[model samples]
Target: MKKKKFLLIVLSLLVLFAGFTLTKSFLVSSKQPAPVPTSVVINEEKAIQNFSKALTYKTISFQEREKFDLKEFDKFIAFLKDSYPNVHEKLDLEMVNDYGLVFKWIGSQSNKKPIGLTSHYDVVPVLSGTESNWENDPFSGAIKDGFIWGRGTLDDKIGVIGILEAAEYLLTEGFTPSRDIYFMFGFDEEIGGDLGAKAIAEKLKQRGIQFDFVLDEGGAIVENMVPGVEQPVGVVGISEKGSATATLSIIGSGGHSSQPKDRTNIGRIASAISKLEETQFDGKLRGPGNDLFEFVAPEMNFGMKYVFANKLLFKPIIEQILLKEPATAALIRTTIAPTIFQAGEQYNALPEEASAIINLRLMPGDSLEDVKEFIVNTIDDGEITVTVTGTEASSISSTEGPQFEAIQQAARNVYNDSIIAPYLMFAGSDAKHYDSISDNTYRFLPVQISSDDLNRMHGTNEHISIKNYINAIKFYIEIMKVTNQQ
Candidate 1:
């Protein structure tokens, strides 16, 4: 009789737990209905012409600074001045560090903190051998098949020209911002942004100028971005991963190829890399990656919604699923990419020293020292010299408040069918540099694009559809207006 009573008690507890979980899932939705979009009119013909013309300049950023052509950059600057006369005439412009452009539109309300829009003009150089793969010349900015084909069309020139065009339009409409607006363009974002964004940020910091928010080019609107949601999703990057380069090197005795030792320096380096790969950084759904799901759960199908809403009960299962894909896996943990391997120069000789460089995109809380220590412990090789050097992850920005709401509403106004969610950026951007000066820096490139288009960035045959280009301008305009009202 006592045994039967204990079994009944256990079953009742299980039933209650299940009931509570289902109820919680149903009530967990945090989605607020988006506001009605304010109609924005832009001159599509003139905007396209300006965007196409801006891409003609060869403002390419090369790893080696000496390879840049100052003439092309200078011409691009001149073109902007010729194109947007209203912006040049009304806003105060300063050329920081020569190529870095800063324009300030003094606000009607001085008590309100300034807001910033930033993007880089420099683009990555196309590979010499891949030029034939392009249907149009990468630098030609060909308007073919309703697509603008060029190198910088997607990587970032869109942000630079889009923001300027919107500003020019607003000025023409006799609209002034309630808060001061600053437009900043960097010249060397492709390399490290040290000369461009870093310099501009330093200058702003010295002036004791703090921004309410600064928006830069990053995550974009995409279809099938998340697995469960059917509508297109626009991801606003609330934080970006820190980039670190770790070098693993070993020195050992050199010998002839025919009689090489069992453990050569090259062998040690390769083995170390293999071990690091097998033992990756811990994948946990915390921080921005976690925040992404909370915002999207309400829109997901019932099954996905249930699993995500009760993460405490199903966290391990969800993480395992996220770990299955390279794309999704990056969201929850730091990533390891072995980019450069250097060892032997000759065909028949075993070099005494071998070195491999592993590039890691660190999670927000993962410090440089923590990453280095993790690498050292994973390899378990006392002989291998491990050295890590790079900047730590940028501070995570708040998803709440007017700063985020303005961006979310602006995106919704332009792409009403899409859901806007905060996501962690796996790659680095110039926005990280601005974090020091701004209270919150958000990375969102206001364009609807696909995975194929993303792959084309810094690759052959890069292009943006005409429709995407126009909407990008509209988003900029909306963002400006919405931010002021907030």
Candidate 2:
């Protein structure tokens, strides 16, 4: 009788587990994007040629303001005028802060709020020694092996040229938009956009101009990064991680080489840093992280779907999986990178002061104050002083809104079969500055790039495929057509 009772209980538990698993496998999908065909014809050869020429200008954004080449910027502007005569003749162009280019394509409906498309023309300075590593000269803008090889090819001159190409084509087709469209090209985005986008946003804000939505570069069509989604997934950044720098420092006696106290300043600082690194902030899969899985789970295989679909019940398990990989891990929590460590000049002498700078990419839920608290608490050392400074994460944009849908629809139109989902941007971009003036600011370049190509964005051998460039132009044209129709 006792054995029978135990067997009955076990059977009941197994049945309950089976029921839960069965229900979890069938996941609910987030959004079903209807097919929208684009008939816009891209002058492929000319588009590639213009991008190649734009790359040769070397509109490099240097940290020091004096290093900016105004002559090159002027030449790029002239090139834009020479290439897109219709855009120059039709749109009212205004130069903000001398070099920041703003073009307004006035629409028939003046009352409708304007949509701003922004991208930076400037590229990061290539490391001195690494320039030789490029197959073609970094500044040559050589079109070789089906790629426009150069610095600005991917980091964003494509955006500037792509937008113009689309607008120019639309003008040639005699298509007048129902809503006003603005193109803002920033020159100083590589450093911080202080004098470029910041100035543009401020000038527009002061003039009482508000944007319906703004699009800038952030996420791209990533392959193999998102698990279970076989087709390339286009990630549109609805919000970005906050960038913060925390300097942990300690000042103590500069001791002699012969004898010293048990714990020197350098040693103490090192220990604190070790503790902070080892005791990293607990990774939590909520906000954008959770939302990302929510969007992708339905498209996942049966097993993966079963795990993510039951997110509420198995959140800990999901977070554990995401935390295992560095790239996926960044999507969930704040990242800590110890960049600079300074202690001693000579080998023998114990330095008086020691400091280390930890750069942190903060999650939307984590604030600057919250990050400081975590570091202080983690280090748990009274001697070490921690100072944190950076801008907070921008407000989360709604994925359910028309603004995001327009972006998703545009990418879907170009890359017909790719899965379009919204995720938080891990890097900083000029889009963050426009948050105040626009109802929603989205970051998507609409170009399909591989993981290797992603690494080359701010690194050496940066290039964009001729196919991707033309597709980007088509995507921009599709975006204009999809949105603003009465």
Candidate 3:
């Protein structure tokens, strides 16, 4: 009897385990088929060679506007014309702001709004002491260990080359777009893009040229980007946080060291900063965070899927867990960080005035007025004055419609197994300049890179794998074909 009871218990456990496995498999297989590309073939070596050669030019953006070397910019353009002869001959090219280049490929029909693709050519300056950190000369155009090394490999230049390669290849194959396609390249994106993308946007707006969508550089494929997910992740920026600078200042009477009041200028400023830190912007999972889970939920394991699939019940708990990490916490709320501070001269004397500069990244619904009010209420010190200067957050673009689906389809076509999802970009990009004329604007970089490679983007030893560069080119071609089909 004892032996029979043990056997029955073991059999029951086995049945339950099998049922769980079957149910999990069913959920995973329920996902819809991803859009597959008609064809994908690109010469990886040739693309790498072209990218390496493009990196030879030093088109750096300096804080002082006069320090810009137009000669190098001219060289970069000349190189493009020489390398992509078919593109130069087939498409109409125009120069704005002397350095910004716009290429228009006319389509069979003119009724539909045009699609715009943009990237910047200029790069940030290489600091003097960081040169030694590079494995090879930063501008040597060196191909080492299956990667093309340089300064602009992962920044905006890859977007420029990848787009041109697709256009040139399509032109060779006698493919013409059904709707107008505009390839806009900016030169001074690193220095705020005032002279490049912003100028181009204003010019296009004046001519009543509106775009169905605008795609620019912002996010890329990252490994372990999310906490629990093991697959490679791709983030598409549907909205970007607003950047603003706030100055807090306090003034008091200067006096000798021995005779001090309870509240000095420095003390007041310090106390205000402490209060602001204690009372940070509200961090709750909303907006882009919610959108991101919708796309990835179907691909997750049962435990993760259950939480995401039934988010209404688990949202508060999930958000509370996310709030524990600072980086993830920023996704749901505005952030405040004191960037610069100024105060007294000598230890013996009290300072008359003290000031601090705070950098704030505003969320979608938050306004400049809301930020000011929050600061005032939190500190509650009338003697301390505050002032703010910057643009409000850009409007959020739609994740629905053929526009977003097209982007997702194109990404899946190139990156076969990866999950493509939408998230809010924490940093600023040139896409903001097009918000006025574009109903949907997305920022995505089509390349598989590790977190280390991501760090190298604006840092030394910046490079891209030969395979990734070819994939990027193929992605652009696939996007063009998909857009035309729609």
Candidate 4:
């Protein structure tokens, strides 16, 4: 009788556990359905034509500084004034550092904190030899085959032109916000936003201005980026990875290659790098990575959903699965890339010094000093001199509350079919500069694009579909309407 009672108790416990697991799986998706844009009507052909014309200006940001097309930038500024006469006429416009633009639309309620929408007008160069690879002259801004082909169309000009298109439409319709709205455009974001966004932030700081939120370009609507979720996920970047370069240098006794030591400088440096690659940062699916799965797990299939919903018990398995792809792997940890390796110039000579530069994208909690220590400890070689320098990751913006909700609602109004979620950005953007002057910052461009199109952002044949561009304009209109209501 005692043994039979014990067996019955065990069966009851198993049943309770299964029931709890099933309950959590069903409750995984807290995402409410996004509202559709029922009343927004935009001039589709005119919006497309305006974007195509904006792409023609070669306002490229070359690292060398001298290669900048100031003339084209001048023309682009003029184009903005001409294209959106209503905006230029009504909003208070100011120029910063010659090329940057700050346009403020005064709100009815002066006491309410202002909000900002920013994007860089500058674009990366069409790498010299690959210009011919484009389907059209990258600067020509050709509209053909249902796509607008050009350099800036995807990398950023979309943000500038899209925002302006919406604002112009709203102004023409005589719609004004209850709270102030600022449109900031930076010219140097392609290199580092120092001259443009950094300067703009400082100017705002001196004026005693603080924003409720600032939106800039970073994430996009991606198809098949996440597994098991059939709808395109619109990722709004709540934070971005920090970038740093760690140099591993070694100095040993000079010797001929013929009579090399067991552990020469070259060998030591190579070993250090090998160890770095072999033992990467301990990958943990926590913080933003965990939150992302939490948001999307409900949309995943039964097998994947079961694993993610019971994350505490199944974390190890989830981490292993995420680590399988480099892209997803980057979402979890500080990534290391061996960008530059330098050693002896001559083939025959093995002089004294050897070095390698590893570029790292830091996680939010990682301090630069701690990263340096982690590298030295991992390599465990006294001869290897590791020097580290890079920016720390941006502070994690709030994923909860009205700021994010406004963004989601705006996006959903246009692309109701896509699943919108907050995510951490792998790349840096001008959004980082606004951290101090705003209550919050969000990075997303309401554009429906594929991974193949994403690759073309800084590569050849860059373009955006006409349908996507039209939807982008409409999305902006909705964002302004919804957020201004807040």
Candidate 5:
């Protein structure tokens, strides 16, 4: 009788523990509030009109950059002043690097560090004959069938106009932030931002002003961006891959084609190139990949959820599957592609020297020295020489911090149905310039875009939906609220 009583007591304790665990899980999941309040209304027509008018200016960044008619940039600035009178009156604006514009909105309090929101005004030069691909003139800023078409519609002008609209609206509504806000607009981001964002970052550094968080243009919303996710995914870039160029050269004895030695200059260089391609850098899921899964895992289907939920157990298999697709492959590993090859000048004579240039995108944990060593060890050719030069990848920002969560929550408020996940940006951006002075740098373009829209960004037929322009403005407003709440 006593033994039966002890068994009943043990079973009761086990049941109680199970109930507690389930209740805890439920509470944790339910604690997060609904992403956005439905009460806030957006003026879609006005936002689209402003975005369309902003795109009409021909502020293309040229590589050689012949004296750009500063008059046009000046006109663009004046147009902003006229269009957003509230923003102009409320925010203190300063011009950096001749054309770069920075606006500071002093907050109700100044104890916390400021947050920066940045975008570039300049667009890439259109190729001479590619204008035919455009549905309308690239600079016309045509609004037709609920779309605003033009260059800079998607690249970055959307961000510039969107933030201004939010600020204008907030100022008119008598909303003030707890922390200071800065809107930084760079003029030459398309041409590497040397005279624009870089100069501004340097100036800020001199002033000893460090930002709590800096948000810039990088990734966007697109369908099928990830292989398995059905919803249109919005990727926020926490870090960007560094770009480097590696040069391989081999010098050998010149001889007649018929009497060429077994290992000539061309053969040695070609062999080295082949070796490098065959032996790529190691592939593993880490950094931004982990952050991406954390955000999307809750919304994933059963099968994807299982894989993502137990990532430590399924990492190798997940990586193998991701490697099969080129687009997905890039996310998990560094990439290498040969861009230039130079060899023989004549048809019959063997060239004295041959060289090849390889472009590499460095992952977060990898460095230029690591790349050089990998090339030398893999090729193992004594006569062939390899040289590498470029910037190493930037440091990864924390995903757990309040800054990241604030950005994610703001994105969710603007894009309620879409998932906001952090990932590494394959392309470089102006945000990289501010990494030295900021604790958290995030890259996100607050616009819903299709995959084809990405091609049109620096290409032909660049455009954005009227709905997306309004959403971009809404996102900025939500970000302001989220940032201040923390």
Candidate 6:
């Protein structure tokens, strides 16, 4: 009788556990029904022509600061004034730090805090030999085959021109915003936005200006990007990973190659790197990474939805699946990549010193000093010294409330079928700098693009479809209108 009662109790517990999970799966959902899209009409031809023309200026941001062509940037600024007369004439324009452009559109209500729309105009330079790979001239800004071919067409001139075009159209329609809107354009974003965006952000902070939210170029509507979700999903970055560099160096005795010691400088460096790779940063599905799965779980097929809904029971299984792909793995944990390895100069002679640089994208809450200690402990070698230097990850922005809802609603109004979700950005953006002055900072590039298009960014043959460009402008207009209502 005792044995039978014990078996019955075990059976009851198993049934209770199963029932609990099934009930939770049925209750949890992140999916929202598609809303009716608001009608927006614009002169498609003129907008396309303007965007195409704006891409012609080679305002490239080179790593070496001396290579920037100030003349081209000046011409680009002039082009903006000439193309959008009303934006320059009506909005208060200030040239922050000479190249940084700040345009403030005063609204009817002064009580409401302002919102900012920002993007960088400068683009990565076309690699010297890769020029031949482009279908159209990299600098041509050619409008053919229903696409505009150029570097900045996608990387960001889209944000600058798209916002201006929408603002110009709104001015023509005599539409005044309920709250103030500021459009900021940075010149040098590719090489760490220190001069352009940082200066602009500091300037605003000095004037005691605090914003409700600031939107900048980042995640976009990607098709076939999210696993198990058939429809295209637009990802807005609520937080971005911090980019830090860790240098591991060693100073040891150099002997003749013929009578080399068991361990050389190069060997030690290689061993340290190998150990770090084998033992990577512990992966945990939390923060923005966890938020991404939560948002998409409802849209996933029954099997995936069930697994994610019962995350408490299946968290390990889900993490194992995510860890399978490098792209997906980056979403969960801080990533380490050894970019530069330098050692001996001569092939035969033993080198006295060796150094390797590991590029790390830190997850939120991971400090640079902590990461350095981790490296030092992980390597476990006293001979080798480790040093880490870079900015910590940006603060996580709120996904709730009207500010975020305005962004989501605007995206839905433009792309009715796409699911807009908040995510963690693996790459960095200028939006991080605005965190000080803005209550919330969102990183989203309002365009529907594929993984291939993402790869082409900062690569050869970068371009944007005409339809996508116009939709970007429409998104900007919708966002402005939606935020005004809030």
Q: Number of the top candidate by TM-score?
A: 6
- Model 6 is weakest, by summed lDDT over 10 consecutive residues, at 29-38
**Which pairs clash in model 3?**
none
lDDT tens per residue, model 4, 130-218? 97788799998899999998988887999999999999999989999989999999999989989999999999999999998999998
Query: How much does candidate 1 score in TM-score?
Result: 0.97
**What's every prediction's RMSD, in angstroms?**
1.4, 1.5, 5.1, 1.4, 5.3, 1.2
RMSD in angstroms, candidate 2? 1.5
lDDT of each: 0.92, 0.88, 0.87, 0.89, 0.84, 0.92
Worst 10 residues of 2 by lDDT: 23-32
lDDT of 3 by residue, 1-486 (tens): 999999999999999866765565455532323758547666666777888999999999898989998898999999999999998998999999899999999999868999999999898877799999899888878998888888888997999999999998899889989999999999998988998999999999999999999999988888788755667778899999999998999888989979999989889998999999998998877888778877777777667876776667678888888788877888888999899999989999999999999999988998999999999889899999999887777778888788887878888898877778889898888999999888889999999998899888889888888888888898899889889998
Provide TM-scores for the models: 0.97, 0.97, 0.93, 0.97, 0.91, 0.98
Two-way lDDT contest, 1 vs 3, winner: 1
Question: Which should have the higher lDDT, number 1 or number 5?
Answer: 1
Model 3: how far is 281 from its true place, Å?
0.7
Tens-place lDDT digits, model 2, residues 243-313: 99999999989868678789999888889889987888889987777777877887777777887877788
Best by lDDT: 1
lDDT order of candidates, top first: 1, 6, 4, 2, 3, 5
Give candidate 1 regions above 4 Å deviation.
1-6
TM-score of 6: 0.98
True lDDT of residue 314, candidate 1: 96
Ranked by lDDT, the better of candidates 3 and 5 is: 3
Error of 1 at 134 (Å): 0.6
